[model samples]
Target: MVALTDEEKAMRDGRDGDAVAAAMDLLIRYADALGAEQLCETRNVAGTNTQPSPAKTKLFEEGGWSKAFSVISLDCDDDIEVPQMKVPTCQLQHGFGNDALGIMPYSERNIELQAGAESFYSSKGVNVLATCTPYQVGNLPTYGEHIAWMESSAVVYANSVLGARTNCEGGASTGSASITGRIPCWGNHLVENRYGTHLIESGLRMTGFQDWGMFGYFVGDMVQEARPVMIGDLGQPDLADLKHFGAAAASSGGVEMYHIPGRTPDAPTLEAAFGGAAPPESLHYGEAERRAIYDSLNSIGNSEDVDFVLIGCPHASLEQIGRVARALEGRTLSAGTELWVMTPRALRAVSDRNGWTATIERAGGRVLTDSCPAMSRVAPAGTKVFATDSAKQAHYLPAILGIEAWFGTTEECVEAAVTGRWRGSLAPAAVVR
Candidate 1:
């Protein structure tokens, strides 16, 4: 272990007499676990969980733990009422939806308790924003810049995709890091730690959005914890596919970094991504791995009748939303089904300004904002079946919310919403070329 300076020792020993000392100690240890060399000042903090849960809000207010750090800005997937403000109204900059999965699993009373606890942060200048893509909100730190982030996909994307440095911090650690302006320079912060440890070889058979997504899940499961660089006859993937892959990777294996042979910014080639050093071992994925991934994560349709048809795991971009609206021209969601298209709040405004919102609403789908079903604490209750195009949601919803959920392509969900039942099987996306 490296020796700590007197000030660092004092910080660990509660020398400042601030309630944040214990939390800092925990962070330091966590950093050590990741084999970090030092600490770095952090900027831009983001969180996960639909809204503030009681466990999170309480630790911040009643636990004597809240005052430990001075975070400059905060963003998250849920919104909460803020109390007497001291810190600048935090930009509830980005968040996720509770509907992506169905609804939050907790009770309303518990949510109320969490809200009461979170009131303290507002008193210190926290804003309630329900968003998932904080990077879309200008909170992004540049490559090699340190940040305290709690969102799993964002942490992975930033570290592995953008070349920024951060660990998948918890809410409390994130809060304390922002307050202290310092985080253990561990994990993704160090260049040596970012090297690829595993090699993934895939044949070109896996194509289409769903195929690419399952490929990510397959790789995550095969490698377990090793950072892998993908190599093969793999074709190019777009942002939507990458976001889906990243979310699935985060869900399946808790991967902090990945190198895409030609896709990711940092990994223009396999050799470059691997740093000319050989991987510890190589793993190959063919049709068998692909089929296994689908079998493990695919959600079965519930009773051949669908109650809710949802889309937007990473928040559909304008073009995606437009594609749906055009296909849905003069069409309406079946009277029996409640169809909702979810997107980021700002993007919602953009859709409205561009008239896409009216077109979608006119098609019997509401363009909702602020939170997703997986991020929100509530949605229509007792829905027997839920449908989504996101494998990430399909993989986690059953355990997190205890509902019968199914995975499908965006078109399948749209058709289900249109007829109140699934009509078609998964189809490949038409070659965009």
Candidate 2:
């Protein structure tokens, strides 16, 4: 029942090419599965998850790269070369870092497979950004533009922070949308679906990124999948605060977009955010709730001789990098501990140019790019305890890396990185309730 354009119909009928036909067929099926009545053109950007699987590469060598592309990306069994992407597309972060950095180790075959995957996508006209925060680089989309982005934190950032429209699309669907330049018209694509469904009146006066993050964790739990309109005297949070908030919310729950009246672009006014209607549900977050959320995120108890401290989950911005540099300027990491700061390569270059990278490196830390501990599964091998400022990382790394995770403020994490001890307290430093 999904309607298609004439060009799309032609491609469906195999007039464009086998690859186009296969991609179109897959998209049509996906639209049908979503119960969408029609397809709409994506106006702004499209991105695919960086998929560099050694198993998939072995399949490619056994069969062919075309078959692998068809089965893996297009979700079809047909053998066809992947057609050039129709819109501006970029690749999200994968499990590997850059060839030169070599921060995370990989086998010879795995490296070759990663290179082959990059080459294949690059040849098919995809800008392999290799980082999750493509917006920080060059793939910036303006307000209200439609994009097909797959990474969870990036999707939330794009919708809530950038005001661009995108759902929590999976890798396959985003890849199909990239090739066809269209996606099923549903779920955040329409203006009616973007309005706030819940109202959150925050009573706690948040001071730093950790406070905002803890508030977001509570709100995400309260609202679940519903969009929330936050009203408070938060006093204009910066980009890093919003980044931590969005990342934590997206991880703890399924929040794709949130509205902070007078802060975010879409929510200029409270009335505008709610679409002139009052929210049916309301929640209050105060000092006690913030402390509880912070304690819940920090699962480690008693034995907290820190082994590793990770700084970025959504990849640190230049400002965040500068903060980390300033914290560790005159200090060195503990003898038994390590610090790894992950950021996008573009921002890493900026850090390098600004001497922040050298400052951290001189302090016995590394500014890594493209991959994190959870993504690459590369820790210091004997790491028993890990600490991070990211609630998202704290939630996932324990299960992924099989270690106790301690979550706290950036300064507290820096202290752990310096002294190799968990001196973080769950109580709020100063609460205005």
Candidate 3:
């Protein structure tokens, strides 16, 4: 077992008094849980916020979280008006309740709980903006710097794309890291730990949204439990495609880290990401593989029955939103259908200013920000049948909602929403014999 240092011991034992002391205590325990050898100071955290549970509330009153929460910056906050979910409780050992789950059943009591929780963090000076992309905020720690992040896309982006280091974090560990300004020097921190273990060779010329998302799921499915460095004759994929792949891979096979050769920073070339270690396995991805991946992940059905259609899982990029607006031109969604396009709130505002939001809304789609069906757990609860373009959403909805969710291309989802039934083919053209 990795041992905590004297400073960590004092903090855990509450010898340092309040505020910073309480925060350090949590960080030490979190590091200990991960068997981390030492702490790395963290400058940022990205995740959702919730109402304080009984233990957390008590701690706030008696300990220093009340003070610590006042100063930290949180990427997102929980809302009582949105849908609620039953999730494994996060940091603070908050009990499993709507308050802890940060879901909506917003009676006056629940509202009070939500407010009380917000007050604790608000009093601590944490930014209460409801968002997932904190890198958009400001002064993001540069590549190779240590960060603590919980949002899947941000974690991958920081590690694989931006060249920063962090592990797949939780809210509790994040909060603890924020308080102590340090995280265990583990996972992505070590240079040796960042090397790729799996090799992905792509034959398809993947460029657009659907292709990218499907390709990501393909790679993720094939490279389970391995860090993949994608290498091939593949051309540059857009940021939307990267987001789609990262989110899908994370959702599908627990791939919190991946390096795209020539695109990602750390892996300027395949050789560097590998660091001289030979890949244990190499998988080839082609049109057939993409179609097969889509077939495997996608529910085979033409029956629409879709009550909801969601487009953004990792938050739509500006270009993706523009494409959506262009595709939906002059088309109206079915009156009964609910369509949501999610993006980072800041980006959403930019779209709103540029008239992309209106264009999408005019075509019967509403744009939401900082939250999605997966994180918000909103659409899945009341929804019987769900439709999304993201493999991540498709993969998680079944486990999270206990409902059958269908994965399709954005066009397929849009057409389904318009017709109140699936109008797309069960098999992609690449898969038909």
Tens digit of per-residue lDDT, candidate 1, span 321-424: 77667767788888767766777677778889988888878877878766566664344566677777777777776666666676766777788888888664
At residue 5, what lDDT does model 3 achieve?
73
Off by over 4 Å in 1: 1-17, 20-23, 32-36, 48-50, 54-129, 205-208, 428-433
How much lDDT does candidate 1 score? 0.64
Write down the worst ten-residue block by lDDT for model 1: 68-77
| Per-model TM values vs. the true structure | 0.81, 0.95, 0.80
Alpha-carbon lDDT, every model: 0.64, 0.81, 0.65
Clashing pairs in 2: none
Cα RMSD for candidate 2?
A: 1.9
**Ten-residue stretch with the least lDDT total in model 3:** 78-87
Model 3 quality (TM-score): 0.80
Residue-level lDDT of model 2, residues 1-433, one tens digit each, is 7898898899789886887777788878988988888877884555554455665666688776666777777787766767777777888877654542444444555656667777877888788777778888888888998888887888888998889998888766777787778878878878899999999988777788888888888888888888988987876688778888887888888899999999899999999898999766668787778878977897554468998899988788888899899999989999999898888888989999999999999999999877677777667657889889898888888888788999987888889999999999865445444
The clash numbers for all candidates, in the given order, read 32, 0, 10
Candidate 3 lDDT over 59-80, as tens digits, reads 4465344332433322112211
Candidate 3 local Cα displacement, residue 360, angstroms: 2.6
Between candidates 2 and 3, which one is better according to TM-score?
Answer: 2
